[model samples]
Target: MCFYDEMKGYHWDSVESEIMNRSRDDVEKALTSSSMNLDGLMSLVSPAAEPYLEEMAQRAHQVTQQRFGRVISLFAPLYLSNECTNSCVYCGFNMTNRIDRLTLTAEEALVEARAIRRLGFQHILLVSGEAPHLVTLPYLTSVVDLLRPLFPSISIEIYPMDTSSYEELIKHGVDGLIVYQESYNEDVYKQCHPRGRKSDFHWRLETPDRGGNAGFRRIGLGALLGLANWRVEAFFLALHAQYLLRHFWKSFITISFPRLRPAAGAFEPPCPVSDVQFVQLLAALRLLFPDAGLILSTRESPYLRDHLIPLGITSMSAGSRTEPGGYAHETHAEAQFAVADERPPEIVAEVIRSKGYEAVWKDWDAAFLH
Candidate 1:
């Protein structure tokens, strides 16, 4: 069954109550358990687990070291367009917003790709607002065809497509797919995305399954924190990840924790997650899925990003530009969101080295599988 159907078996209220009712003994049991499961994840993120933060961090660190070693894979986001059809209230690219829209041509995207290539990024993620007309498959495939020779690893974070569409892109050297559910709560999801194609919650929820069937090499999943109670959201996200991992055993699953940030509409996170809670959630995810990647992006501050490296983050996006044509051109286009860590790629790599971790530019090549 698809995750939406699997999700129906568990009631949200019941899960939240169980998490809140966890005791210190439950937290200890989770920490000492040989194999971590969904039940262990509950104890690790509970209020009772707050007092065991240090212990959780220590265990998360050791699991990460054993599973991934001391390396952090780094990539940069190459925004292709800011033309969105969605009216997501929390996003800067909401269709109702009066921001300038831009979509890069193949040549223009190559210019940005070359700029990112010079910055030493062998892995690239193509980003755009959810406007299918502007960011059509023909347009995306053309851009990927032009960029395939430059970067070995290319991923896309755009509108969801059918399995055939994802398969076609994979044939053109696009091997990874990243989709954020925004919020796992169906009610909050509907309220936040009031209009556009993104409003179809079940369609979006089943996207990774399509990508998996298309044989994507990597599948990334996350819920935008702060939309609902974080503990509830995290639980659903973990459930989603667990479902994907079991069905799509061939694809590597990565999880991202993107806390809501300030954008054009000035929407505030109704349920803000504090630093301690964020750490707890991250470490809890690490213990639950030790081999799955934990990605930290520039939405966070530099100081916090630096400190979060050892916790369980296996990948990061460095020197990211969140708007179209940001790298090669000097456009005054408004960004999707303000970058909290504006340091260049070199400086970010330097900091990773100081933390005794190797900053990897490229870890996979299509040639290896062939």
Candidate 2:
């Protein structure tokens, strides 16, 4: 049975409403209190919590420095294919998009991996559109088998799969999985993903559950910020993260805040999240979950990334190419969105060093997992 079937009776909308209705006092209590629990997290994301941004930032910085020190983990994305079966309206790789689709063979994948590694990226995020027939478990496993010897850590941001499939990948050296809910608003989600496998909201919602069950070392969660009310969706994401943390304490958790970028077939954001608001949300997340990993992608400008690095961001993707076969084979292919920070990975590392932070290329060793 699907994991969502078990959680079907539980209502997420009611909890989201409760969080949105939080008061100033609750926000203050959450900010000042030592042991800020799940309720505290709700208040931090509430609208009334705007006034405590500075305080939250201060605590976030301290907590971040204390836990992670003056270090920033760096990684880059490798888009293997653009052939998708899903029709997610907000993405350029959607099946409906009329663009060139490319899937890398094992040799092609190695060529791209070598190019990425040459730039000193030891952590790689393997990405592909949702096409199970083309990007099946065996295909992905083969890619992992080839890249595992090159990169120390590898994570996937692809279509959702069953627990057994995830287990198979994990055994083949997949370190982590990042599966965003896009938005927690069920109606909006359904509207955004009109057809194909992506329309099944409950299945997408339960992806992390499946990952946890498969014994993944880490699972990343987030809502695409601009798609819905950042506050409400973030609250649900935090709740989901909290639930996973409580139930699967062994699995490390990370959160990414990817504001929507202009894609091939664009859709206007219902709720546009500003830079300041995004910072506030990041600070609040840090204050709430001090030990959790916060990631910023190349979608933000270099200036914004520099400012955010010290605040709470622990990991970042630099010089990302979102298009399929974007690195080695084709650079002018269709991209999911235009990357803001177009600087190369080495330049990004220089910026990190300028800020008195070490850019970590490899933190995890393959033997450690064994």
Candidate 3:
């Protein structure tokens, strides 16, 4: 069975209650546990774990060093389009928003790629809103084909597709796929995505499975914080990650932490996560999944991102633009979201060096697999 089927066994409220009921003793047991299971994760993310943040951070750091060493892989996001058909309430690219939309041609996308490459990014994430008609499979593959030689590693953060479609993208030199569930809570997910293909929660939930089946070397998953309770969201995300790790053993698994940010709709996060709680959740996830890659993005402020790097962040997006042709052309297209960390790639890399870790511009290449 897929994760959607496995997820049905546990109810949201029951999981939330279990986390809330965790006592300090439970937290202590989880901290010292050798095998970090979902129960250990629950106790670590629970409120009782608040008093032990320092301890957890220490353990998380040790685990991170053990698994990933003192290095952070840096990449840039090349926004191919801001056009979307989805009316996601939290997204700036919502179809209903009165914003300028643009989907780049292959040449325009290549221009953006050159700009990102000049910034010393050998790894690129191609981002676009879910505008299937405008950003079709052939269109995406063509752009990937044009960019195959420029970047050593290419990844996509776009719409979900069937397994066959994903396999075609893989053949076109795309090695990674990142899809966020936005909110794992079905009711919340439906409300956030009122109209669009994204409204089908189960399809989106099973996206990584398709990506994995299609042979993507890397599959990224995340739940947008602030849409639901952070602790409960963390629990469900960990559960999903565990499931993928078991079923898709060959594909490297990564998790992203994308907190809600201001965008076109001026939407506010209903269940905002505090900096402390965010730290707790990050530390908990690191302890639970030491080998998994935890990604931090430019959506968070530079100060926060800097302090968070040592806590378990393995990969980061530096010098990112969320609008189509943002790097190369002068366009009026609206960004999918405002970038919080505006530091240039070199500056971000220097900051990473200041923390005594190496900043890796590219960690994987297509040559390595062959």
TM-score of each: 0.99, 0.95, 0.99
User: How accurate locally is residue 39 in candidate 3, as Cα lDDT from 0 to 100?
Assistant: 94
lDDT of 3 by residue, 123-147 (tens): 9999989989999999999999999
- The Cα local distance difference test for each model comes to 0.93, 0.87, 0.93
Please give the range of 10 consecutive residues that has the lowest summed lDDT in model 1. 361-370
Ten residues in a row with the worst lDDT in model 3? 361-370
Writing each residue's lDDT as its tens digit, candidate 2 over 328-360 gives 884556888889999999998999999889999
Q: What tens digits encode model 1's per-residue C-alpha lDDT throughout 55-76?
A: 8999899999999999999999
Ranking by TM-score: 3, 1, 2
At residue 235, give the lDDT of candidate 2. Answer: 69
Rank order by lDDT, top first? 3, 1, 2
lDDT, residue 339, model 1 = 90
